[model samples]
Target: MSTSTGGGVPASRFLFLGTRAGHSIADAEYEAICHYAGLPTSRMDRVRLEEGPMPQIDLDRYAGVITGGSPFNSSDPITEKSVVQQRVEADMSKILDEIVARDMPFLGACYGVGTLGTHQGAVVDRTFGEPPGTGHIELTDAGRADPLCVGLPDKFDAFLGHKEAVRELPSHAVLLATSGPCPVQMFRVKKNLYATQFHPELDSTGLIERLQEYRHAGYFHPDELDRLTREALASEVVHPQQILKNFVEVYA
Candidate 1:
């Protein structure tokens, strides 16, 4: 597919698929990502997959797709999942089918790892869930050579907290980066489709805000909110955002 908009108009902006139900939190996440991407708020389209059915978006109208983290875990049994989670998962499956077939540009963060891994037949469970905090991630040989990892350092800190992760990468997937707790921190499918266990779009500020909102959501002890905020604030996470900026530059 052509990545440009014909007739001298600027290319269509990317779509950010957010699953967070809280309007404030969802908007904050989307705005933070767009800020780092150097794209105006107007250049990005935000969709809340949790609110209702996935809208019928024309792929040709977007340069790529970005899916954010969520409270839902793909490892949960069908009977345990909420109706919204199930519906969102089904919609994501159809979207990924088209993305993979066309090799369209995509970036799935946090919960996105579970969604894409499950769809690709990978083993996704809570076997390697990391706590809510900053962790160091190292790029593998494959990751070093990947276009998205071009300007990134071999090792860097990133915000992460997940209840489930990919236990085994899919047959067609290439492992990109790895963390101490999560073996499959990042991976790629056919180059364009990428999934990461960390939140590439988040900074210390963004993560701190999330910590406050999700403290009671079971990511961590409610009393540890203050300590968690301090730890996240102390961490220097500058390189991870490069991945987001690079994706837009390369594909948009």
Candidate 2:
């Protein structure tokens, strides 16, 4: 992992806020995102938010912030959440307040939807959770013209599995993509702040690994792990990665 002395000015760097507590899972998530962005891992400074307080990052120094998925769900009752989860969520609120105020470039995936949604006063609940697998995503008319959706077909497949999702897009956000099961698959706050309920940085291999690692974490029945792996391997998901690449190209 690339280390940074906190409180430095943001240069041409990118900040990746990852909340995964497991070292291997966190590393894989960060590496996969950097790979898709066609950026060397060193160019993206990683901060494991679950470890402690969110670092004091100078937003001006980084091109943008890219947040990774986590086991933490925004819909969980406050009392049910772990101390780390609460702290991370609180930190995100402060960070997002600044990011939104400036319309700073940001892309959040999976758990990101919850964070951004909660911050914007959108309804986030378990009503829209999806099981583990590739879901068919359809771009709205607005999505088709969005720069991030450029070169992506109107309909494509993306990997997703979450215990909660944005029930309704925040008033100021634009809906970009939607799946049959989840209405708010992707949305943008202001112009530069984006969030996706799916994992655009993930592919079949990465999904398989995540499923294996989180098998007992309630995404799906533990007995179906092998079956889910087979399904993920067989699915052809290609365009989602372009979103990450586009975010890097447009902002970085």
Candidate 3:
């Protein structure tokens, strides 16, 4: 046989997907999100994609997928993401389509909740949601039963930084986790597809830094900064980062 230009297939890779929306800067805010999620912001495994469409990365080559939050609400006005954001969302839609078709392993956090929710036909209108301060997150009965939150203690601490939440779950999505303020904090679809309403990827320190950076962007009010930041930094409930390790273990 003629010598082939390509070698045998390489081992599977893991992808950490992130999106930064308007007024969402790169340095501290972005980096901290990655850090909290157990992702290497410094490495190739971590890819910061926009809110729109995504590329077609091979499922066999990548172990799984991870998504981060963004300022673009799945319920935003048409003009929210701008041209670039719009394009990115479109691209990501293609990628997500592939993920669904192949039943690929995936985890979506924050904005992922919205995108996945909207995609799955869940009403994404921001009627029953508001950003809340740090607090203990408790899994619902269904949440405790899920593989992702299974044996994860009925109660745990997580850094929650979001503006909107699921007013209702998609038709087939199972309700998995919840906090005091946000009931639809976590859910799953078709077994492998998952989404979290909280920032499961970040720790307290990372969150504190992010709070300072994304403070005015709207996670919290400027006047509430001192109290909110201090409480969030002192909280020990943000163990959802372990969820990343757990996901890597289960999928990859």
Candidate 4:
């Protein structure tokens, strides 16, 4: 039972797990990630638990759960997997241990920052990663007084290409934002449990059309994919579509 378009509407329901599946990117980047998580593409239903066999929701049937981005690497090297990507990383680590033991309302991007930052114990590595452009991000002051990033735009535009991050931050995470090459670009493990190493449901013409269809599938450097798709198509958006309308106006 996969679904997400503006959810069932009694004010609770937004499940969308995927280690990569909504036609595997580019249906307008899965309709700009279910239209920035308020889900409205006629109800996006498909729990593509990384293409294995998803069907175990029940976090009160969801009012939040949005995981995306993947090339499969919850810190990989499991003999370079293929048993359905090691059973979708063991069914997303038992659904991220029931979404960090019920601190739900999760939002994960780029492999969910290595599957909820390596299941909340942090220390997932690739050594300070964040390649593949759209640099310049900043917002710590508790992420500018976060209401899911208050008043944004002191510098924005994020759509990173990961290799694993969050080298340390799990004692019930906090660290709102930072960048230079990535230093936990966003985090939060208590208040509605958020996460984002950037890719807040992409824009700029759907991230330059998935960077021209994954630009040889390597992020950057196919001779810099025509200068990173012309600076992700002349940059300047620096992200701010209301931060998903303040996460759908904080539970609408």
Would you estimate the TM-scores of all the predictions? 0.95, 0.96, 0.84, 0.31
| Cα lDDT, all candidates | 0.88, 0.90, 0.69, 0.70
What's the residue-level lDDT of 16 in candidate 1? Answer: 90
Candidate achieving the largest lDDT: 2
lDDT digits (tens) for residues 202-246 of candidate 1? 999999989988988887889999898889878898999999888
Candidate 4 per-residue lDDT over residues 1-252, each given as its tens digit: 223334345545466666554473734555677776566765454466655566655565556777767767767678877788788877877877877777877777777778888877888878876667676778788777878776687667676777678788877688888877787888888787777887877766777766666677655666777787777778766465456557656754
- The global Cα lDDT (0 to 1) of model 3 is 0.69
Better of 2 and 3 by lDDT: 2
Sort order, lDDT high to low: 2, 1, 4, 3
What would the TM-score be for candidate 4 when compared with the true structure?
0.31
RMSD of each: 2.6, 2.6, 4.3, 17.3
Error in Å for residue 216 of model 3: 1.9
Tens-digit per-residue lDDT, 1-252, candidate 3: 122223344344466667774444544445554454455644325545664454445556666777777767777778675777676676567678878777788888888888788878787776656554565678888777776774477888777777677888867898888765777878888979898888776666666666777777876678887887778766786467767667766764
- Give stretches of model 1 more than 4 Å off: 1-12
Backbone clash total for model 3 is 20
Pick by lDDT: 3 or 4, better one? 4
TM-score, candidate number 3 = 0.84
Candidate No. with top TM-score: 2
The predicted structure with the larger lDDT, 1 or 3, is 1
